[model samples]
Target: MALIECKDASFAYEGVSVLEGVDFSLNAGDYLCIVGENGSGKSTLVKGLLGLKKPESGQILYGDGLKSTEIGYLPQQTMVQRDFPASVYEVVLSGCLNSLGRRLRYGPAERERAESNLERLGIEDLRDKSYQALSGGQQQRVLLARALCATKKLLLLDEPVTGLDPIATGEMYNLIKLINLCDDITVIMVSHDLHEAVRYATHILHLGRRQLFFGTSAAYRESSLARRFLGRDRI
Candidate 1:
């Protein structure tokens, strides 16, 4: 069954269309990578999925039958985020806010869950350190641990490896693959690099101002979409 469904979705800004006639579904444990140029509405689509923006037309249906709190999101980490004063433990623990809400105290269970998530991402040692003090790779892992604390069923990561070095990007991709393979988490991500997205994603969503493409990796490889947008040499 589909976990997320969008039908005839459309969005616009200042009377200019951004997304139109977008229809797609995400099943449990599926990994979908969204690729597009800077102005192609990739970030807008993420906002739409997160309910941060209202679509001009159509609807998004979450069919996992989960509550709104169950949706987990990890947005791109910008340079400014490097200075966030929170400790790794504190940031990861914040992910439990949707579940814990305004609770006066976090009990043993919540603490355990946070620790386990950190451990799963192999960053348990950094839990007590300040988020601002960690290396780029460490910081991303910490944020990913935070997202894992939100939900195990679905993970939405937008431009996750944007500013990392090549080695860090490769490590991040390996971690993402392991998260999907071992934990069965459905991964939906937005990316600018076609090669990286194709290397890891099972499904691809290509967005243009007035056009888009959605298909499995094999199908995407077989299509001419790469030649037009990514160039033949890159493919």
Candidate 2:
């Protein structure tokens, strides 16, 4: 079964429609990239999928043992968030808070998971480091570890490489690709980098002002939408 399905989904803010009649499905181990122009409701669609916003019409279905709260999320960072006062371990361990319910302390299992994620990201050495003292790339890796502590089934990333230099951006993409392919985690990403999207994603969902395109990456490369917006350039 599909991990997540959107049937005729639509969203609005203050009654002004931002997305309408959107339909899609995400399967296990699929890397789905959502791309669009500004104001095309890419972020809104993600909010709807995450259940942070109620769709104006239609339904979002979750199957294959997936729950709304079990999905890991890596949001776009702000300057203030980049300078947050905390240790890397502290931030990552907090991701288990959702599973703790009313508990005040983390269990041994949660701690193990956090440490395992840190090691998986090859940032075990930075566990005790101050979050603000790390480079931009390291900071993003820490955040990814935090998100992994939340779930192993699925990850939602929004503009994860927004502020990094090209080298950092490439590293981040490689990390995410490894997580998706090796860890077998389904990835749903909101990205503006069309070139990288085509390179990394297995499937593409392109949202225009009033149009939608969904298909395999190879097929998307041949669509008029890709030709018009992305052009023939591979970069």
Candidate 3:
């Protein structure tokens, strides 16, 4: 069964349609990369999926089983996060806050999950380190570990590799690929790196000014529009 299903979804701001007639389905283990220009409504679509914004028309369904918070999200790190004075362990443990049962303390399961996520991401040694003291790649991994502490079912990433160096970018993509491909988790990510997306993603969701294209990576490579925008050899 599909994990997420969208039917004829459209989102508007002040009656100005940003996304129109969008439809897509995501299954477990599917990795879909979202591609578009600056004003192509990629974030808006993400917001809609996150339930932060309601679509003006149509429906969005999450398999009638997953909780809203179960959709793990790794947003682009901003300047605010870079300067935050929290330990990496503290930040990761925060992912367990929402799942707590009105308690004022961390349960054994929550702590174990956080620790496991950090260990899985190879940041167990940095658990006591300050968040701001880590390098850009380490910071990204910490945030991902935090997200993974919540759930491994559905993952959403928004421009997660923006300012990182090439090696960091490659490593981050490889981690995400492992989560989606090896762990059987579903991924819906917004990416500016067409080359990485083409190499890793099984499906591509392209958003234009007022249109959307949903297809497999090979199908996107065959389209003239995708070829023009994403480049011929790039895909």
> Highest TM-score, which number?
2
Between candidates 1 and 3, the TM-score winner: 3
* Model 1 deviation from the true structure expressed as Cα RMSD, one decimal place: 1.6
What order do you get sorting by lDDT, best first? 2, 3, 1
Q: Candidate 1, residues 20-137: lDDT per residue as tens digits?
A: 8778888888899999989888888888888888889898778867544576889888768889898899999988777787788777888999999999988988988999999888
List where candidate 3 sits over 4 angstroms from the true fold.
none
> TM-scores across all candidates?
0.94, 0.97, 0.96
Q: What TM-score does candidate 2 get on C-alpha atoms?
A: 0.97
lDDT of 2 at 234: 55
The model with the greater lDDT, 1 or 2, is 2
Residue 143 miss distance in model 2 (angstroms): 0.5
- Candidate 2: tens digits of C-alpha lDDT, residues 1-235: 8999999888889999889888989899999999998999998988888889999989999999898888899988978877789999999998887789888899999999999999999999999999999999999999999999998799999989988999999999999999999999999999999989999999999987443799889999998888888877753
How big is the positional error of residue 36 in model 2, measured in Å on the Cα after superposition? 0.7
The TM-score measured for candidate 1 stands at: 0.94
